[model samples]
Target chain A: MASPKILIIGGGPAGLSAAQDITDAGGEAILVEQEGFLGGTPKRLHYSLLAPDLKPVEEVLDPLIDSVQQSGARCMTGAKVESVNSGRNGFTVTISGGGKKVEEKVDAVVVATGFAHWDPHKKYEYAYGVYPDVIDFKDFEKMLSDGNIVRPSNGQVPRRVAWLLCVGSRDRQVGKFYCCRLGCAVSIKQAMEVRRINPAIDTYVYYMDIRTYGFWEDKLYWKSMEEFGVKYIRGRIGSINRGEDGRLIAMAEDTILQRPSEVPLDMVVLATGMEASEGTRETAAMLGLELEEHGFVKPLESDSMPVSTAVPGVFVCGTATGPKAIPDSITEGSAAAIKALNYVRKRSIKVQARA
Target chain B: MPIHEKNLIEKEDLLEKEKAVVDGVDVSGRWNTFIRERLLSDYHEDFVEEVKSLPGGRTVTNCWQCGTCTSGCCLHTDYGLREFNPRYFIYLAQIGNVDELKKYGDVIWRCISCNKCVERCPKGVKVEEVVHNIDEVLRRRGVTEDTPGSRWDRTYLDNIMATGVLDELGLTLKYVRAEKPEDFTRGFMARMAVKIIRNGNIRTGPIRRRTRGWKKMKKVAEDILERDGYASAK
Candidate 1:
């Protein structure tokens, strides 16, 4: 039988990893990404270092992207998967770009449309978009990668910084109840980086719970405290505004002391959480895949069959299913690749038996 | 609008001019209260390290401030003392904010050792031990003074070390004499001394009686207390 073709819709850690794994396993893979580049959010944001390990982004993603490119899998950049129509032979997929449309026949589909950073502006009290000194995780990553820890307001090294966790995640007022899962570690990592950039900055993280779940509870959160002196205060930020000194002032009740504390800082970092990206939403709609309440692609059985989507011959992985870390996304990418490859094998068998 | 959680602001920081006029405009009382802005704390950076050096304080850093320990605290649920929250105290100590621990020094001693916090704590913080250690540190730093009850305990323990058995009469006399010189004129110690003589409950004599085998065990008890960071009686 000819090589089974698999369509991987995304070019992120998960999509790239899936494409690499499938091609390495002797299955033909076609990778599609909407951006002109292939490296997903980390590349788009120019992420300097990843969390938990603090490895340079290029060390991990660069090789993954390169390996997938060299694996002989057809790759499409700056294009979108317009539609998918299933038939007895397999799926007829439409790709549209540059006012052109191309069709391909694929044995299976893997939707790895990753997540988007939650918009901090939704919590208007934070003054994320309005204030020049305030920035979210996405913007901070880019700023950090640019190698300057200066306030946008004056471009001076910040003397005091405050990281407010749970800006847009774990907040019912915004209709999002699930924990962002990555913010605590991300905030801790950023706080460490800020302090490393300038040892004098008094960095404080105000949080209700430092949910640095998994091994990160010690590796990232506690080490950030013992090694870097990044102070942790049990307080939820009430609001942020410009003070008389042109510095940002954050108001919070240091719940430990049961007294309100007004923290004056040169910069305020909102550890914004992740949500379903627009691509994730659009792909789900186009493919007739079920989405959970949070709009992430619904799995066949999230606990046991996590990579299998609601539609047969279709698989989903990474933040496309929910908010997850880079390592987990990559793992799910390989997992989805294996499932897609198996489905193709079974399809060829069915066709041969029918003949 | 500026966020002023007025209820959470300290009472002393809310300074207001009662019934005053400023520039032909009335600015007085709660209507024009001034909320004092707090400065960043230099934090006793070694506070957690100091606590860990003491007995029963090693796990203080394990706290994540989940409040699970506080939710099941008997001192909070039964005694109705809101200041006796284990989670809050642990967080304060962890942050090295000794200034904030001032208001909570006395309450730390009130821990009943119900161990509810230890059982409920997901981080394995020995909550009961941390509470006692905080009390110990407060007393050592003179943030808290010896209450009459604590003074009585000191006298009682002194008598125990002197003699294997507890001498109630010696305990009473020692406690009375150890009272402040000014306390002699008008205090429970003065009244108690007078009652002891008036009733002839004790013969006026030296506390020469010492329990047998006390020397061997007294050394052990003193060793334990010293090792636990309590080198003195009170």
Candidate 2:
């Protein structure tokens, strides 16, 4: 029968990574992305070496996308699968956009939809929507790209800017107690970016804990704080409000100080947590896959195994499994592709043996 | 030789005194009463029987007190208490000392229930669930509501059952009252004074409960409670 059709959802590092592997393994594949382009958040990110000293997103991803496109795997941009139904043999996926409703049959599916920045609107105390200068880390990045990192209220470079790490993360009150794996390091990277832009800017990171695990621990945290004088305030932000002149005012009980202090800031960027992409729930429902409490597709056995989902035919990799940086996502994506190929090829072998 | 001999004689005298006390008590029998008093109680009996009836209750006894599960837990990550390991709690359950378990009740409540313990457990102990049941035992014993954390959890179902929707203001009030009454006293007076100053509504506070779908939600919540039989005091 026609080469076991493979359909991969999401076009980010995970999706593209899976596509490359699937093509190499001699499987028919279709890679679909909701955005106009293939690269996901890594495209939006302008930080230096996330897993430090690793290849940059542009250097590594550009060629992979090209190779996957050349490998006969059809790339569909701005396409979304509306619904999917699976049977014993294969899956029927209904897609929309490009002025038409189309259907495709695939023998297997890989979910790599990745993750989204956790919404802080639910946290009313943060005054996210009400305050002009309160933006999530991603929005701050976009603002930085456009112009100076100055408060929108006044036309001056920020004297005091605060990064409230773990806004929606590691908070049981909000039902997300699990650490989003890469958030701590990501916050440090962002703070470093601000310092690089304007050395004079007073950067204070309000955190419950600084979880700089592994090699960059000494370099990122110790060097940034002791050597460069980035303030590591030990506390969680209790609330944030807009000041008279429109500057952001943060209220937090500095555990070290043992008193509540109001720090006036030109801009407050909440290093928001990560959650499974919006599409993951829908995709999981269609394919009869399991999702963990945080909505990430539950790994079959994450501790020992790699890139295996609960379902027999379906698999998930990268941030879709949990919050992961680009390098980890790429590695997981390749592992997931190998897992799918093994399943399909094994079935083919069984058939040949039976005959 | 006489001085050395005198020292040996003195050491022998001290050893005789220690042995006299040791011989008066049987080492094996010493633990029997302690175990019987706490372990054979109705609470311990019920906890053990209930756990045994559950899927892996028998496995709780199979634990070798390895302490691996506790070591692997994320609850010990800086904020957590080293003494509050779930594996030790399980061992306590196996030994049947309900009182010792009760003594460590607050620490058990300190568990954020992250389930890292469950995931890492080599023996597949439902660490969170088992600890949750132990917490139930503490609540039944009528321990002081020390913190809003412990009290809210104990009465969470009841609050949801009575009001239908979680009363945000009520929760805050309950928290303030349970944990820090002084903080509550200051906050309450401050709110009242602020209300008088601003001429805000005194009949109710700034945060009001949505009584709209509350009745319906309350009914649904009540049904769940009645089905679970949580309305009555344990």
Candidate 3:
């Protein structure tokens, strides 16, 4: 059977970048996206509040998305793959969507399916289910995009908005270790946005510690204080309860003050951590790929082995491997293409030798 | 160093000398050998082929034995015990050592079910659930042996069983009374004195009295004891 032009799983930054990479390397690649749209989480995120260098998701990913399209990379949106089986010649991919099960034969599979936000409902004490106003960063982003900061219960502009950090990430209880790598910065950015919009409103950021470990972090911190007047308290919110007025009252022992205080907030934004996407495990199995405990796809061993799985010809890129920035995803995507091309060429050489 | 003193197989063989006969058991899935041996001799070839047929199992077979899962294990660090590393456990599970798995009841129970090792493993092994499943199997076999934590666990369960819920005051009283009767007497006096100092009135009411469902709860506890399950020695 003739192998697929090329099959790239995931429609996000990583998948798109890999498609572009493959095209640039004079190979045909297909980009399969689970979601209806392309840009992934970055597109869903409100990046206007982020640093200047980190351009808006639309502006940043536009060129790459365009390049993939222009380069004749077939983009399949809303594709849910069920299984993958590799044979001596190529891989057989079975995808089910839109009342049809489509099977595609591909020479190599690049898993860049990315990661999902860890659900906060598992941490039952957070009252995520009972409380209407308790939400995560993704919810906050959508609310911010709607151009309103109103509580769902009262439909009133939130006077007191508490942004909670490390809701699911960095918690031993939930088994999610190794911080989500972006939640802290994202929380700070979101808090600044809220503060900028309504100076009269009370903005409190409850955090274990400000993990702005990146360069130019000091500038961001200072800007949050001087420009936006964001109040950052060093402590974790222990419990959340509903007030008589249907507002969320967050209780935390303010370590700096050495006193437990209850803050009645109109909204609580739980900055949840990222986890490997659901498809990752199944896809890893299908391709006979290796995964890290985090459920992210394991990367090739060295620079020379960029896209190769433990089993030859199977490859992985982007957040499929681990949590990575967009720039890194694009870089790895290109590197993966080069490696895939090399793998195919080598396999063909072996085939000729056997013949 | 001790594990390295002799070959692993020899060390295991010597350890087998201390193996106690399980009461009222006849047939096991594997024969009268240690877990490693039974796995290799009776089942290795067929099980390997079986797993290779499974996609998930195929990926499992690709493990290069880097020991990353074992090295990153929290259970190993916290308990200072390693009856089964995540890597070894997976290997055994693949080879079907269902009987010998009961030996890891304590270490397996202490898992806290954390996925830390799973997240850090470069090979993406499901370490938490695999250990948990083994623990479930052990639980079914009535092989629950208490570790060092058995004493406090028993006391806690006893307190809960006696009183529908926990009785902090009563629990402390009972635990202290059993462990240190003289100290408990002094503690009682100190508690009264502190309450008086704080101007808090000490109520002589029951610390934890039986509620409406107390009868049902007692019956349940009695049933649990007589269920042919292993209990820690008093």
Candidate with best lDDT:
1
DockQ head-to-head 1 vs 3, winner = 1
Q: What is the DockQ of candidate 1?
A: 0.12
What TM-score goes with each of the models?
A: 0.71, 0.58, 0.56
lDDT of 2 by residue, A91-133 (tens): 7888886978899988778888888888999888998887767
Give candidate 3's error at residue B222 in angstroms. Answer: 88
- Report fnat for all candidates as fractions from 0 to 1: 0.10, 0.00, 0.00
Off by over 4 Å in 2: A44-57, B1-234
Candidate closer to the true structure by lDDT (higher is better), 1 or 3: 1
**CA shift at A55, candidate 3, in angstroms?**
3.6
TM-score of 3: 0.56
Weakest lDDT window of 10 consecutive positions for candidate 3 chain A: A46-55
Estimate the lDDT of model 3. 0.67
Model 3 clash pairs are: A291-B123, A291-B124, A293-B118, A293-B119, A294-B119, A297-A320
lDDT of 3 by residue, B10-48 (tens): 345432323344576543433234433212211122333
